[model samples]
Target: MEDSHSSTVYKCHLLNGEHVYLKIPYSNVKFHRELEAYELLKGRVSIPELLDYWSGDEECPGAFLLSELKGQSLTREVSPTVAYHVGVIHASMHAIQPPSSKRLNGIQNEFSNWSAFIEKQFYSFAEDVKEVLEEGLFNQSVEKFKKMNQQLPSPDGPSFVHMDFRPANIIIDGNKVSGIIDFESVRFGSTEVDFTKLYRDFLSADTTLYQAYKEGYNSIRPLIDLDVVLSFYRFIDAFNSIGWCKRRGIEKNTVFLEENTVRLKEFLR
Candidate 1:
């Protein structure tokens, strides 16, 4: 299973001084995901082109080589116009229908129904997070979701979604998006789930960016209504992050663990 950690990306300069990236992925599953995602999204989106890959054995991490997308990672330092471009790129990703084989490869994203998928995320990850979180917090969160379940909208389409669509995944060259990176979490699922990280990390802090993002997305495609299920999805995102840290290593993720704990508590309230 691919965890929360990304592959190590190494920049290599050719004799001519041009560069490519040598990526040593965290898991074989991630290697498969990057390879498949790069292959499927070629020319469809601004992604690094994959050059070669290795499935790797238990003793060694899976790895890959790919072309580099030269630009800065689109972090908090972004403008509304750039956010709009990111929105367009994201909407395009959601418009795709990944093959069943690729869908099944993402073990966590195999569910066809978004509601069931969210339920399973809570049920399975809840056990892993119980020890890591404060006492009774898990139960409280479960009850909260149970109540919200009654109000959740119908299942969104099983479209391809960038599972980790945050600013860090977006690359900006001037006002436009040069490329997007890290497709290891690509999956076919509800598009609303993709909004959580981007909203929490960037758009939530700036209304102009959020509005422009929506406008850009709507210009390319009609979202059923992100507002309706955003809270539900966002809560799931926070809850899952807590467990992800616990499973990956609490010691190494103190800041992330603390932030997610705060988010989880806020959501419960």
Candidate 2:
């Protein structure tokens, strides 16, 4: 089966012809992190059961795994109910507090406080666009982000968050969410971080779905200052992405940077 990005996934069939996904990662570090995440999340969430994993020798220097998960990637037909169910599952995942030893969140500690982490991340990335961005606009954005960061209170809890939770990552069997794949980006962080995709991307695009998700989440674990938190992290993510594109010299992502900038500004307001 052809999955996305740097993974080599093979649909390996057994003697009975039953198949399991064998995932091999390009980096040993990523391989170990993902293996740990799967081990941590097993039976807690609707995810693929980790069948086997091998941390190869120095000669090979990589890792691979076999696992089984039922259902396919969600295509076009996502209704409000599906969105709501996704929200509920997401909340359940967030409720789980992982061990402190887990350095899971993608960010590698630039700042002490999580809120400061958000501001520092955006400012660091916004620096990449200094030459391209107008001086006044850039300064204005900086001030706004600073103010927003100042107002951010301590996070309620640090929970296990699937940093890349989206439609493509979720698997559905009929109306039920059978499993969520792609644990490489899994981490422990503010629960608000998990809502960025749903609120900023999915919910913003569909009001009915947004309402249903809100209802579902509130029924399980209601979020406080949702709009503010969503905006805060959305802005941080946009700027971080912009910085990454700039740093990597990926000109193709210019449009993406611009779009995120606009969204970043909206959230800043």
Model 1: pairs clashing at backbone N, Cα or C within 3 Å = none
Tell me the spans in candidate 1 whose CA falls farther than 4 Å from its real position: 1-4, 99-111
Which ten-residue region of model 1 has the weakest summed lDDT?
102-111
Per-residue lDDT tens digits for candidate 2, residues 167-201, read: 66788777778878876666566776777765655
Tens-place lDDT digits, model 1, residues 1-269: 12226567778989998989888877777677777787778888889878887778887667888887878777767788988898899888877775656444533454366777678778888888888876799888888878887798766667777789887778899889988888877777778778888889888898998888888888878866878988988888888888888887889888888998999898887
Against the true structure, candidate 2 has what lDDT? Answer: 0.69
Of candidate 2, the 10-residue stretch with the lowest lDDT total is 104-113
Q: What is the C-alpha lDDT of each candidate?
A: 0.80, 0.69
Rate residue 158 of model 2 by lDDT: 71
Off by more than 4 A, model 2: 1-28, 56-61, 66-68, 74-76, 100-112, 123-137, 247-255, 265-269
